[model samples]
Target: MQEAFSQTKNASAVKNNYDRVAWFYDPLSRIVFRNAQIQAQQALIPYIPEHANILIAGGGTGGILEAIADQYPAGLRITYVEISEKMIRKAEKRFTGKNTVTFVHSAIEDYAAKSHFDVVITAFLFDNFTQEKADRIFQKLDKLLQPDGKWLFTDFHIDKKSSRSWKTWLLKSMYLFFKFFSEVEASQLPDTTSLFKKAGYHAIFTAFWYRKFIHSSIYQKP
Candidate 1:
Protein backbone atom coordinates (compact mmCIF):
# COMPACT_ATOMS: atom_id res chain seq x y z
CA MET A 1 0.00 0.00 0.00
CA GLN A 2 1.03 3.59 -0.57
CA GLU A 3 0.65 4.46 3.13
CA ALA A 4 2.98 1.67 4.24
CA PHE A 5 5.57 2.68 1.64
CA SER A 6 5.41 6.30 2.72
CA GLN A 7 5.82 5.28 6.34
CA THR A 8 8.88 3.21 5.54
CA LYS A 9 10.49 5.93 3.45
CA ASN A 10 9.82 8.67 5.94
CA ALA A 11 11.09 6.57 8.80
CA SER A 12 14.29 5.90 6.91
CA ALA A 13 14.82 9.58 6.21
CA VAL A 14 14.20 10.53 9.83
CA LYS A 15 16.46 7.84 11.26
CA ASN A 16 19.34 8.49 8.89
CA ASN A 17 19.30 12.23 9.35
CA TYR A 18 18.65 12.38 13.09
CA ASP A 19 21.39 9.82 13.72
CA ARG A 20 23.78 12.17 11.96
CA VAL A 21 22.73 15.18 14.02
CA ALA A 22 22.09 13.57 17.41
CA TRP A 23 25.32 14.64 19.04
CA PHE A 24 24.93 18.30 18.09
CA TYR A 25 21.16 18.67 18.43
CA ASP A 26 21.07 20.08 21.95
CA PRO A 27 23.56 22.88 21.46
CA LEU A 28 22.20 23.73 18.03
CA SER A 29 18.63 23.89 19.30
CA ARG A 30 19.55 26.06 22.25
CA ILE A 31 21.47 28.47 20.07
CA VAL A 32 18.64 28.78 17.57
CA PHE A 33 15.52 28.66 19.71
CA ARG A 34 16.99 29.69 23.08
CA ASN A 35 14.51 29.23 25.96
CA ALA A 36 11.53 28.81 23.66
CA GLN A 37 12.11 25.04 23.46
CA ILE A 38 12.00 24.64 27.21
CA GLN A 39 9.08 27.03 27.51
CA ALA A 40 7.04 25.04 25.02
CA GLN A 41 7.45 21.86 27.06
CA GLN A 42 6.81 23.70 30.30
CA ALA A 43 3.51 25.04 28.95
CA LEU A 44 2.20 21.50 28.81
CA ILE A 45 3.55 20.20 32.10
CA PRO A 46 0.90 21.83 34.26
CA TYR A 47 -1.77 20.08 32.22
CA ILE A 48 -0.27 16.63 32.81
CA PRO A 49 -2.03 14.90 35.70
CA GLU A 50 -0.30 12.88 38.38
CA HIS A 51 -0.08 9.09 37.82
CA ALA A 52 -0.64 9.67 34.10
CA ASN A 53 0.67 7.43 31.31
CA ILE A 54 2.42 9.67 28.78
CA LEU A 55 3.84 9.04 25.34
CA ILE A 56 6.58 11.38 24.10
CA ALA A 57 7.07 10.79 20.38
CA GLY A 58 10.19 12.19 18.77
CA GLY A 59 11.37 13.71 22.04
CA GLY A 60 14.82 14.82 20.97
CA THR A 61 17.73 14.92 23.46
CA GLY A 62 15.54 14.52 26.57
CA GLY A 63 15.18 18.17 27.58
CA ILE A 64 11.48 17.71 28.15
CA LEU A 65 12.13 14.56 30.18
CA GLU A 66 14.58 16.46 32.33
CA ALA A 67 11.93 19.11 32.95
CA ILE A 68 9.34 16.47 33.88
CA ALA A 69 11.68 14.69 36.28
CA ASP A 70 12.49 17.96 37.99
CA GLN A 71 8.84 18.92 38.35
CA TYR A 72 7.20 15.57 39.08
CA PRO A 73 9.82 13.15 40.22
CA ALA A 74 8.07 9.86 40.89
CA GLY A 75 4.44 9.48 39.93
CA LEU A 76 4.23 9.44 36.14
CA ARG A 77 4.85 6.69 33.59
CA ILE A 78 6.46 7.88 30.34
CA THR A 79 7.37 6.16 27.08
CA TYR A 80 9.93 8.19 25.15
CA VAL A 81 10.34 7.18 21.51
CA GLU A 82 12.92 8.45 19.05
CA ILE A 83 14.05 7.23 15.64
CA SER A 84 17.72 8.00 16.26
CA GLU A 85 19.62 5.53 18.47
CA LYS A 86 22.24 8.11 19.41
CA MET A 87 19.56 10.60 20.40
CA ILE A 88 17.94 8.02 22.66
CA ARG A 89 21.34 7.26 24.14
CA LYS A 90 21.80 10.92 25.03
CA ALA A 91 18.36 10.95 26.62
CA GLU A 92 19.14 7.81 28.64
CA LYS A 93 22.31 9.45 29.88
CA ARG A 94 20.31 12.48 30.98
CA PHE A 95 18.20 10.35 33.27
CA THR A 96 20.43 7.45 34.17
CA GLY A 97 18.53 6.18 37.18
CA LYS A 98 14.97 7.28 36.43
CA ASN A 99 12.59 4.39 37.10
CA THR A 100 9.35 5.67 35.58
CA VAL A 101 10.71 6.34 32.09
CA THR A 102 11.21 3.86 29.26
CA PHE A 103 13.16 4.85 26.16
CA VAL A 104 12.33 3.13 22.85
CA HIS A 105 14.67 3.56 19.91
CA SER A 106 12.20 3.43 17.03
CA ALA A 107 10.45 5.61 14.51
CA ILE A 108 7.05 6.99 15.44
CA GLU A 109 5.28 4.90 12.79
CA ASP A 110 7.00 1.71 13.92
CA TYR A 111 6.26 2.25 17.60
CA ALA A 112 3.40 -0.01 18.65
CA ALA A 113 1.66 0.85 21.86
CA LYS A 114 0.53 -1.98 24.12
CA SER A 115 -1.88 0.35 25.88
CA HIS A 116 -3.29 3.78 25.18
CA PHE A 117 -1.76 6.72 27.01
CA ASP A 118 -3.33 9.62 28.89
CA VAL A 119 -1.10 12.24 27.28
CA VAL A 120 0.97 12.39 24.09
CA ILE A 121 3.70 14.98 23.71
CA THR A 122 5.16 15.89 20.32
CA ALA A 123 7.67 18.71 20.12
CA PHE A 124 9.12 19.96 16.85
CA LEU A 125 8.56 16.52 15.35
CA PHE A 126 5.74 16.73 12.80
CA ASP A 127 7.35 19.46 10.72
CA ASN A 128 9.84 16.98 9.22
CA PHE A 129 7.28 15.55 6.77
CA THR A 130 5.07 16.63 3.90
CA GLN A 131 1.49 17.59 4.66
CA GLU A 132 0.01 14.26 3.61
CA LYS A 133 2.53 12.28 5.62
CA ALA A 134 2.01 14.51 8.65
CA ASP A 135 -1.74 13.99 8.37
CA ARG A 136 -1.38 10.21 8.26
CA ILE A 137 0.99 10.25 11.23
CA PHE A 138 -1.38 12.45 13.20
CA GLN A 139 -4.23 10.02 12.53
CA LYS A 140 -2.09 7.11 13.72
CA LEU A 141 -1.13 9.02 16.88
CA ASP A 142 -4.77 9.86 17.54
CA LYS A 143 -5.56 6.15 17.79
CA LEU A 144 -2.82 5.61 20.35
CA LEU A 145 -4.29 8.03 22.88
CA GLN A 146 -7.00 7.16 25.39
CA PRO A 147 -10.43 8.72 25.06
CA ASP A 148 -10.47 12.13 26.72
CA GLY A 149 -6.69 12.26 26.58
CA LYS A 150 -4.55 15.32 25.88
CA TRP A 151 -1.98 15.89 23.15
CA LEU A 152 0.74 18.46 23.78
CA PHE A 153 2.07 19.89 20.52
CA THR A 154 4.69 22.54 19.79
CA ASP A 155 5.98 23.66 16.38
CA PHE A 156 6.34 26.52 13.92
CA HIS A 157 3.26 28.15 12.45
CA ILE A 158 2.86 30.89 9.85
CA ASP A 159 -0.27 32.97 10.09
CA LYS A 160 -0.74 34.59 6.74
CA LYS A 161 -2.95 37.44 7.86
CA SER A 162 -1.47 38.49 11.21
CA SER A 163 2.17 37.46 10.76
CA ARG A 164 4.67 39.68 8.95
CA SER A 165 6.22 38.83 5.59
CA TRP A 166 9.71 38.41 7.04
CA LYS A 167 8.50 35.66 9.35
CA THR A 168 7.20 33.72 6.35
CA TRP A 169 10.50 34.23 4.58
CA LEU A 170 12.40 33.09 7.64
CA LEU A 171 10.30 29.93 7.94
CA LYS A 172 10.92 29.09 4.30
CA SER A 173 14.62 29.67 4.75
CA MET A 174 14.67 27.42 7.81
CA TYR A 175 12.85 24.68 5.91
CA LEU A 176 15.27 24.87 3.01
CA PHE A 177 18.22 24.74 5.39
CA PHE A 178 16.83 21.69 7.15
CA LYS A 179 15.96 19.98 3.88
CA PHE A 180 19.55 20.19 2.75
CA PHE A 181 21.25 19.35 6.05
CA SER A 182 18.66 17.21 7.84
CA GLU A 183 17.01 15.45 4.88
CA VAL A 184 13.61 16.80 5.83
CA GLU A 185 10.87 16.01 3.32
CA ALA A 186 8.65 19.04 3.68
CA SER A 187 9.38 22.37 2.06
CA GLN A 188 6.67 24.14 4.05
CA LEU A 189 5.13 23.82 7.48
CA PRO A 190 1.96 21.74 7.71
CA ASP A 191 -1.24 23.14 9.22
CA THR A 192 -1.24 21.12 12.43
CA THR A 193 -4.18 22.96 14.02
CA SER A 194 -6.51 21.98 11.19
CA LEU A 195 -5.20 18.41 11.16
CA PHE A 196 -5.75 18.03 14.91
CA LYS A 197 -9.25 19.48 14.63
CA LYS A 198 -10.03 17.00 11.87
CA ALA A 199 -9.03 14.22 14.25
CA GLY A 200 -11.69 15.35 16.78
CA TYR A 201 -9.31 17.22 19.04
CA HIS A 202 -10.09 20.63 20.52
CA ALA A 203 -7.39 22.99 21.66
CA ILE A 204 -7.72 23.56 25.39
CA PHE A 205 -4.72 25.86 25.71
CA THR A 206 -2.70 27.70 23.11
CA ALA A 207 0.29 30.07 23.33
CA PHE A 208 2.42 31.85 20.80
CA TRP A 209 6.07 32.92 20.86
CA TYR A 210 8.51 34.89 18.70
CA ARG A 211 5.79 37.14 17.29
CA LYS A 212 3.46 34.16 16.65
CA PHE A 213 6.03 32.43 14.49
CA ILE A 214 5.86 29.45 16.87
CA HIS A 215 2.90 27.97 18.73
CA SER A 216 2.44 25.61 21.68
CA SER A 217 -1.01 24.09 22.09
CA ILE A 218 -2.68 21.49 24.26
CA TYR A 219 -5.47 19.62 22.51
CA GLN A 220 -7.90 17.32 24.22
CA LYS A 221 -9.93 14.47 22.73
CA PRO A 222 -13.51 14.91 23.83
Candidate 2:
Protein backbone atom coordinates (compact mmCIF):
# COMPACT_ATOMS: atom_id res chain seq x y z
CA MET A 1 0.00 0.00 0.00
CA GLN A 2 2.72 2.43 0.94
CA GLU A 3 4.72 1.57 -2.15
CA ALA A 4 1.74 2.06 -4.46
CA PHE A 5 1.01 5.44 -2.87
CA SER A 6 4.61 6.45 -3.32
CA GLN A 7 4.39 5.70 -7.02
CA THR A 8 1.07 7.47 -7.38
CA LYS A 9 2.48 10.54 -5.66
CA ASN A 10 5.00 10.78 -8.45
CA ALA A 11 2.40 10.50 -11.20
CA SER A 12 3.34 13.83 -12.74
CA ALA A 13 6.91 12.70 -12.93
CA VAL A 14 5.64 9.61 -14.70
CA LYS A 15 3.73 11.64 -17.31
CA ASN A 16 6.66 13.91 -18.03
CA ASN A 17 8.96 10.92 -18.11
CA TYR A 18 6.95 9.32 -20.89
CA ASP A 19 6.64 12.60 -22.79
CA ARG A 20 10.39 12.88 -22.79
CA VAL A 21 10.94 9.33 -23.99
CA ALA A 22 8.06 9.09 -26.48
CA TRP A 23 10.40 9.66 -29.41
CA PHE A 24 12.42 6.53 -28.72
CA TYR A 25 9.50 4.41 -27.45
CA ASP A 26 8.55 2.73 -30.70
CA PRO A 27 11.91 1.29 -31.63
CA LEU A 28 12.62 0.06 -28.11
CA SER A 29 9.13 -1.41 -27.75
CA ARG A 30 9.46 -3.24 -31.05
CA ILE A 31 12.69 -4.81 -29.93
CA VAL A 32 11.23 -6.02 -26.59
CA PHE A 33 7.68 -6.83 -27.67
CA ARG A 34 7.95 -7.79 -31.34
CA ASN A 35 6.31 -11.20 -31.11
CA ALA A 36 3.48 -9.89 -28.96
CA GLN A 37 2.65 -7.23 -31.56
CA ILE A 38 2.46 -9.88 -34.27
CA GLN A 39 0.09 -11.95 -32.14
CA ALA A 40 -2.15 -8.95 -31.55
CA GLN A 41 -2.25 -8.22 -35.29
CA GLN A 42 -3.28 -11.79 -36.08
CA ALA A 43 -6.01 -11.78 -33.44
CA LEU A 44 -7.49 -8.57 -34.83
CA ILE A 45 -7.59 -9.84 -38.43
CA PRO A 46 -10.78 -11.86 -38.10
CA TYR A 47 -12.73 -9.08 -36.39
CA ILE A 48 -12.51 -6.42 -39.12
CA PRO A 49 -15.94 -5.78 -40.58
CA GLU A 50 -16.45 -4.46 -44.09
CA HIS A 51 -17.12 -0.71 -44.45
CA ALA A 52 -17.10 -0.15 -40.72
CA ASN A 53 -16.03 2.88 -38.71
CA ILE A 54 -13.19 1.94 -36.38
CA LEU A 55 -11.69 3.63 -33.34
CA ILE A 56 -8.08 3.17 -32.28
CA ALA A 57 -7.06 4.42 -28.85
CA GLY A 58 -3.42 5.04 -27.92
CA GLY A 59 -2.35 4.01 -31.37
CA GLY A 60 1.38 4.69 -31.19
CA THR A 61 3.57 4.48 -34.27
CA GLY A 62 0.43 3.47 -36.26
CA GLY A 63 1.76 -0.01 -37.03
CA ILE A 64 -1.51 -1.66 -36.03
CA LEU A 65 -3.46 0.97 -37.98
CA GLU A 66 -1.30 0.35 -41.05
CA ALA A 67 -1.92 -3.36 -40.73
CA ILE A 68 -5.64 -2.74 -40.40
CA ALA A 69 -5.56 -0.45 -43.44
CA ASP A 70 -4.08 -3.20 -45.57
CA GLN A 71 -6.79 -5.63 -44.51
CA TYR A 72 -9.72 -3.24 -44.16
CA PRO A 73 -12.11 -3.06 -47.07
CA ALA A 74 -12.20 0.09 -49.15
CA GLY A 75 -14.47 2.79 -47.68
CA LEU A 76 -13.79 1.76 -44.11
CA ARG A 77 -12.99 4.73 -41.87
CA ILE A 78 -10.59 4.99 -38.95
CA THR A 79 -10.09 7.46 -36.09
CA TYR A 80 -6.68 7.27 -34.44
CA VAL A 81 -6.55 8.75 -30.94
CA GLU A 82 -3.20 9.41 -29.34
CA ILE A 83 -1.98 11.53 -26.44
CA SER A 84 1.69 12.11 -27.08
CA GLU A 85 2.70 14.79 -29.59
CA LYS A 86 5.85 12.87 -30.40
CA MET A 87 3.91 9.74 -31.30
CA ILE A 88 1.38 11.71 -33.38
CA ARG A 89 4.19 13.33 -35.30
CA LYS A 90 5.73 9.96 -36.02
CA ALA A 91 2.39 8.53 -37.13
CA GLU A 92 1.77 11.50 -39.42
CA LYS A 93 5.14 10.97 -41.01
CA ARG A 94 4.49 7.26 -41.41
CA PHE A 95 1.11 7.78 -43.05
CA THR A 96 2.02 10.75 -45.22
CA GLY A 97 -0.14 11.15 -48.37
CA LYS A 98 -2.84 8.87 -46.96
CA ASN A 99 -6.23 10.36 -46.25
CA THR A 100 -8.13 7.31 -45.08
CA VAL A 101 -7.92 8.15 -41.38
CA THR A 102 -8.49 11.00 -38.93
CA PHE A 103 -6.00 11.63 -36.13
CA VAL A 104 -7.21 12.97 -32.80
CA HIS A 105 -4.53 14.56 -30.64
CA SER A 106 -6.07 13.84 -27.26
CA ALA A 107 -6.46 11.16 -24.64
CA ILE A 108 -9.34 8.73 -25.05
CA GLU A 109 -10.84 9.79 -21.73
CA ASP A 110 -11.13 13.37 -23.01
CA TYR A 111 -12.22 12.52 -26.57
CA ALA A 112 -15.89 13.16 -27.30
CA ALA A 113 -17.14 12.15 -30.72
CA LYS A 114 -20.79 12.21 -31.71
CA SER A 115 -20.52 9.12 -33.89
CA HIS A 116 -20.50 5.74 -32.18
CA PHE A 117 -17.74 3.49 -33.47
CA ASP A 118 -18.44 0.06 -34.90
CA VAL A 119 -15.27 -1.30 -33.36
CA VAL A 120 -13.01 0.12 -30.65
CA ILE A 121 -9.46 -1.17 -30.54
CA THR A 122 -6.91 -0.48 -27.83
CA ALA A 123 -3.37 -1.65 -28.25
CA PHE A 124 -0.99 -1.49 -25.33
CA LEU A 125 -2.91 1.30 -23.64
CA PHE A 126 -4.78 0.24 -20.52
CA ASP A 127 -1.75 -1.09 -18.72
CA ASN A 128 -0.68 2.42 -17.88
CA PHE A 129 -3.48 2.98 -15.37
CA THR A 130 -4.25 1.87 -11.83
CA GLN A 131 -7.33 -0.27 -11.15
CA GLU A 132 -9.48 2.75 -10.36
CA LYS A 133 -8.41 4.60 -13.44
CA ALA A 134 -8.94 1.50 -15.57
CA ASP A 135 -12.49 1.17 -14.29
CA ARG A 136 -13.25 4.77 -15.21
CA ILE A 137 -11.76 4.31 -18.67
CA PHE A 138 -13.80 1.17 -19.37
CA GLN A 139 -17.01 2.90 -18.31
CA LYS A 140 -16.24 5.72 -20.72
CA LEU A 141 -15.39 3.28 -23.48
CA ASP A 142 -18.74 1.51 -23.01
CA LYS A 143 -20.46 4.78 -23.79
CA LEU A 144 -18.41 5.35 -26.91
CA LEU A 145 -19.27 2.05 -28.56
CA GLN A 146 -22.40 1.23 -30.53
CA PRO A 147 -24.87 -1.43 -29.42
CA ASP A 148 -23.39 -4.01 -31.77
CA GLY A 149 -19.85 -2.80 -31.57
CA LYS A 150 -16.89 -4.86 -30.46
CA TRP A 151 -13.90 -3.97 -28.33
CA LEU A 152 -10.50 -5.43 -29.19
CA PHE A 153 -7.61 -5.32 -26.76
CA THR A 154 -4.15 -6.81 -26.42
CA ASP A 155 -1.75 -6.66 -23.48
CA PHE A 156 0.73 -8.54 -21.30
CA HIS A 157 -0.41 -11.40 -19.09
CA ILE A 158 1.04 -13.41 -16.25
CA ASP A 159 1.68 -17.06 -16.88
CA LYS A 160 -0.96 -19.25 -15.24
CA LYS A 161 -0.11 -21.46 -12.25
CA SER A 162 3.58 -20.79 -12.71
CA SER A 163 4.60 -20.63 -9.08
CA ARG A 164 2.94 -17.58 -7.57
CA SER A 165 5.98 -16.55 -5.55
CA TRP A 166 8.28 -16.43 -8.54
CA LYS A 167 5.69 -14.84 -10.78
CA THR A 168 5.12 -12.08 -8.24
CA TRP A 169 8.82 -11.36 -8.03
CA LEU A 170 9.20 -11.45 -11.78
CA LEU A 171 6.23 -9.15 -12.24
CA LYS A 172 7.75 -6.54 -9.93
CA SER A 173 11.09 -6.70 -11.70
CA MET A 174 9.53 -6.33 -15.10
CA TYR A 175 7.44 -3.36 -13.99
CA LEU A 176 10.47 -1.57 -12.63
CA PHE A 177 12.37 -2.06 -15.89
CA PHE A 178 9.41 -0.88 -18.01
CA LYS A 179 8.53 1.99 -15.64
CA PHE A 180 12.01 3.41 -15.93
CA PHE A 181 11.28 4.22 -19.57
CA SER A 182 7.49 4.15 -19.89
CA GLU A 183 4.39 4.84 -17.78
CA VAL A 184 3.17 1.41 -16.66
CA GLU A 185 1.53 0.21 -13.47
CA ALA A 186 2.74 -2.96 -11.79
CA SER A 187 -0.78 -3.70 -10.58
CA GLN A 188 -2.19 -3.51 -14.09
CA LEU A 189 -2.70 -7.17 -14.76
CA PRO A 190 -4.32 -8.87 -17.76
CA ASP A 191 -7.75 -7.26 -17.62
CA THR A 192 -9.21 -7.30 -21.13
CA THR A 193 -12.04 -9.65 -20.19
CA SER A 194 -12.86 -8.29 -16.74
CA LEU A 195 -12.93 -4.70 -17.95
CA PHE A 196 -15.31 -5.68 -20.75
CA LYS A 197 -17.58 -7.65 -18.44
CA LYS A 198 -17.86 -4.85 -15.90
CA ALA A 199 -18.65 -2.42 -18.73
CA GLY A 200 -21.58 -4.66 -19.82
CA TYR A 201 -19.94 -6.33 -22.80
CA HIS A 202 -19.94 -10.06 -23.51
CA ALA A 203 -16.69 -11.77 -24.28
CA ILE A 204 -16.74 -13.22 -27.79
CA PHE A 205 -13.24 -14.43 -28.57
CA THR A 206 -9.79 -14.54 -27.04
CA ALA A 207 -6.26 -15.59 -27.97
CA PHE A 208 -3.15 -16.21 -25.88
CA TRP A 209 0.31 -16.13 -27.32
CA TYR A 210 3.49 -17.84 -26.05
CA ARG A 211 2.06 -19.16 -22.81
CA LYS A 212 0.56 -15.96 -21.49
CA PHE A 213 3.28 -13.63 -22.77
CA ILE A 214 0.42 -11.67 -24.32
CA HIS A 215 -3.36 -11.83 -24.63
CA SER A 216 -5.83 -10.65 -27.28
CA SER A 217 -9.49 -10.47 -26.35
CA ILE A 218 -12.63 -9.40 -28.25
CA TYR A 219 -15.83 -8.37 -26.51
CA GLN A 220 -19.16 -7.58 -28.14
CA LYS A 221 -21.31 -4.74 -26.86
CA PRO A 222 -24.76 -6.23 -26.71
Best by lDDT, which number?
A: 1
Model 1 residue 197 CA deviation in Å: 1.5
- lDDT (0-100) at residue 66 of candidate 2? 57
Model 1 bad stretches (over 4 Å): 1-16, 96-99, 162-164
Q: What does candidate 1's lDDT look like per residue over 79-121, in tens digits?
A: 8888776677777767423437777767787887778999999
- Collision pairs in model 2: none
Question: Per-residue alpha-carbon lDDT of model 2 for 134-158, expressed as tens digits?
Answer: 7787888778888989888887666
- TM-score, candidate 1, is 0.88
Best by TM-score: 1
Q: How does model 2 fare in lDDT?
A: 0.67
